[model samples]
Target: MNLIFHVRSERRVTFHPYSSLNDYIDHACCFHCRDGDWWLAKSLLTGDEGFIPCTFVAKAHSLEVERWFFKDLSRRETERLLVAPANKPGSFLIRESETTKGALSLSIRDLVAEEGDVVKHYKIRCLDNGGYYISPSITFSTLQELVKYYTRTADGLCQRLNAPCKAMLPQQPWAQDEWEIPRSTLKMMERLGAGQFGEVWMGYYKGRQKVAIKTLKEGTMEPAAFLQEANLMKKLKHDRLVHLHAVVTMEPILIVTEFMCNGCLLDFLKTEEGRKLKIPKLIDMSGQVAEGMAYIEGKNYIHRDLRAANILVNEMLHCKIADFGLARIIETEYKAQEGAKFPIKWTAPEAINYGTFTIKSDVWSFGILLTEIVTYGRIPYPGMTNPEVIRQLDQFYRMPCPEGCPEQLYDLMMGCWKEKPEERPTFEHLQHTLNDFFIATEGAYEMQP
Candidate 1:
């Protein structure tokens, strides 16, 4: 059997007499060729076969000089160099009469190669899995932007890229009909914030109901894992936990939940209201978070990222634990890859060095969160980078009490940050300690005001 391989010209070269059929060799031309440097090649484009220098052509390679299409090249020249004929699937071409090189003005005959009288041309905006134009007006400014958009939003690409987990995820009632929210009911408002795999938006549901819409930011998150998280979230319900409302199972996946009027706990503390925040209010907030975490602990769930940022607050100064994507449900210690990105300043020494995550490690993060509350969202380690913080922790260097921080609360923070994971106080213990403080101060606090 003759092996078929494509030949791409590295530079302009003339075909030898044995290969030439009165046709000149052009750049970016794809042709099937036999093995050998000076072998005969058959043009897939014009049905011409001739001997061409193998050194001049790259075998079955992508267009490396695509950057040149935007520089010093006319639209016609770009088409000639990079754009394959419409007959070729997965070929990119500029739209007719388009002078500016915008993603919206280009079309692709994606790998499907469907049969039709006129080949279907797909714009960058309409390339979603559902092929439904959610926003026809949105267009990428450049080719890189278009590439990025596809890399994240393409469901097929994301699945193929992300490695499958070794352990089988337990099946849950994730596909329940009542969990699905209609896409039309969600009116997206201002974007709240964004992370590696998702973006949060403050949205309105059913016209008047407020909700926080968490949407996957294209290719960042694995769909299976995302679904598992949603299912886990639905099963969990607590007063100090963020409430999940519904999930939109459409092209752009959305996880809708109750809107926290005050946003992230850390960000809120950094604002003017946080600066003037009373000790009683701070204690109340910390107690609430500890209560939520204790509930998670009871369920054998380890909240890996238990920092102030992952905690949300409401208008009434009520705090709730949020962002459980990194949280794990395990009986013992759970270890992850060593090089994975983790919150350095907030993590325990064991978690940072050995990749071990447990309830105790979460207690360590709770200590950091307490410091954040005391300092009104000031960073745990002042003027130290993550690496420096790690080095200091290794040397048993702990942060001193924040200014105006109560000595009793500071003692609890230190207990949570013990060198040995086993030595750290449990979330249940921490909650009781905070509750005692509040009870002792409530009469004084109330009488003073």
Candidate 2:
């Protein structure tokens, strides 16, 4: 397998694996993200006819090249990736037909190689409907060298993965000494939303793939705690949790994930009346949230940050739980003692004082999500501070459903906020109830109530 690396600078484009001179100059200049500033040219290797060339510049996306391309597959399946002779080592191939247009994703992963342990990764995606190219003769490189080439470039690169590129000269070939991706490279990384770790940016791994990169803060024991959460996310396999596409131990620490165009559910809730949603549609959307929550709880994981804002939607408005930085994995038979507390406004009363993290704690959070849906995505405790919300929880509190809130739905929320954890309904029960509630409130569907 052959892997091509692009060294972009204001001066010229450099080709690795030394392919044809014409193909080198003819950089298709494939750009990533929105601004149209990015571009990469691919060339078949001359030394090895099969491998192709693809470049990596910085962008708001694509920082997690390793995770975005290689982490999710089984070892056996990963080895099956038909790499071209010029591609990188330890990388796999993806057939175009395997993915969807709405979620155009491809990858190269599972490099067990060392530089003495250097693993080079490369990934490609065709812009138009022109089918994908899965080469067989690929080569390999190390992430260390790839990072060096990225830095020594010209004006650096621009963001906007989908941004149109200025047409470049036809094909040409050039090669230069290794360089670094640069300290300012952090400036080029795209913001990937936030979590307990801090804001994430899009970055590159082994000079390939478009991915959401997450960054966290520094403090005593913070790294250890962060890795614990990251490792847990790595081991998880539910469609509900925002997928941890890949994890890297790069110096400052970085995480890469699949980008979700719909932003977060908190943002979507603000537009409940938008064309993409109606009452029935909204209820169904909320149903997915419960389904995801139930899945996590089923695995004995407690989502401490269960709220509308923590939920995310993709281009199709499909809901997925996110921000596992505050999650806890409970043993199958685990049970907490008294005097434990979680998020009060979103937590069951029993959990607040007893430190109990039962599945019911999630149900309490789900109730708050219900109010968010009923109120067109309003915060559960509007105008209430953390202490104030806690004060209310101390009094057997529940946020009231809006004026036209359906009675059945109101009853369900009331059950969820019951002072005793045991009094809450299971997610499975609430899921069915929400469906029945939707059917009962069909008239409201048209009224936009």
Candidate 3:
């Protein structure tokens, strides 16, 4: 059977049967037939025949074949891409409307308006004739034709299409080069610690770069499920989140990430150096975690496990969110599988009762994490079991503020632990508030000295 595929990465044909043919570059298209783990294909662009690795390309058809089509982009992500510096006015992209199933949204960046660069979105309607139209009066048999027509004339749009928004390539795991590193390149050193699925080790990449390598314990989890975190990490890149360097998909399934010199926030807080940290410094650390969570939330992701143990600190005391094994993209109807374990103390009431996790649930966990930070790694609801904590929460009882914790900071934590999920403050708001608090606290501390 004939199949169509889109080349996601640059591939040099070094294997037999097609070694002399041209290399397949990013965004290239090909028609191919499956040959074991390879694609015996003819390039649509150059008509060159080759046996390409299955991992080098992804099966694509219809609207997905278009560079401007972003199948899974959310409205917020669409706006962010359009307004990016690399994309100029008239840059546009087509995405499936989040609110309307099967409908498409045409988002375009316009020239600077009074409020600055404005992004306008138009809905593309489909007629009974199978033609597409934005204004109903102008119709095209195919979406590609419509894009071509719009590219030439604005007609009744904010601006004529100039170019597709600069593609954010990192969202696709295969788009990254040298991401599947050879096992020989990594030199495993001393064991750092162990977790639910594996042991983490302090390793050296190429004998120079320090990295944290986590090895999967056999029979602990399915390989695909174990690599889910790596796949998610590949898409998310932020200063406040631990960076994924590479992964070994072979047996042992190693995940290598940027090494945090100071280790986990929980352990760090209990250390001598951590105990000496001032109130302003602690606030600054909390703000950093909030900033990272804000970025993750904005990207439509939820960190199901948002406890201090999952937060890591570098030598500079900069905190980053880590351990994304339990994280997932926010979806309409998501519930953890039956028998799946979750930290009850760090979980929200709704999440504990229904296994339903959302960004708001993460906020509740953040409040528990705040208690940990304030009390230097004290367990939440001390002297109470998980069931007791749940019972107390049902009675509308919240954790009392830790001793020496600032009143304003404690108030922020309480706001995060609201009974209703919708009543909780968003990570974005938390980040801004914490940042402002840190600035004020730092100024007052300086004045005292």
Q: Give per-model CA RMSD.
A: 26.2, 17.7, 14.0
lDDT of 3 at 426: 95
Give candidate 1's error at residue 221 in angstroms.
Answer: 2.5
Each model's lDDT = 0.65, 0.51, 0.79
TM-score of each candidate structure, all chains considered together: 0.58, 0.53, 0.59
Q: Which pairs of residues collide in model 1?
A: 19-50, 19-51, 152-218, 152-219
lDDT of 2 by residue, 243-313 (tens): 67655444455555555656678777676323334454456667777777778767777777688787877
Question: By summed lDDT, which 10 consecutive residues of candidate 1 come out lowest?
Answer: 163-172
Residue-level lDDT of model 1, residues 1-449, one tens digit each, is 34344443333334433445322334334445445335566665666666665433443433322321222333322322222221233334333234334333333333322321112233334454424231354445454454545545543221111110111111111123547778998899999898876789998876756689988766555667677777877777787899777887655688888788789998999888666666755776788889899999999998899999989976556688988777777878788766789889999999889899999999999999999998889988989999999899989999988998989999999999899999999999988788567445323111100
Each prediction's total of clashing residue pairs, residues at least 3 apart in sequence or on different chains, is: 4, 66, 0
Model 1 CA lDDT for position 420:
91
Which structure is stronger by TM-score: 1 or 2? 1
Best by TM-score: 3
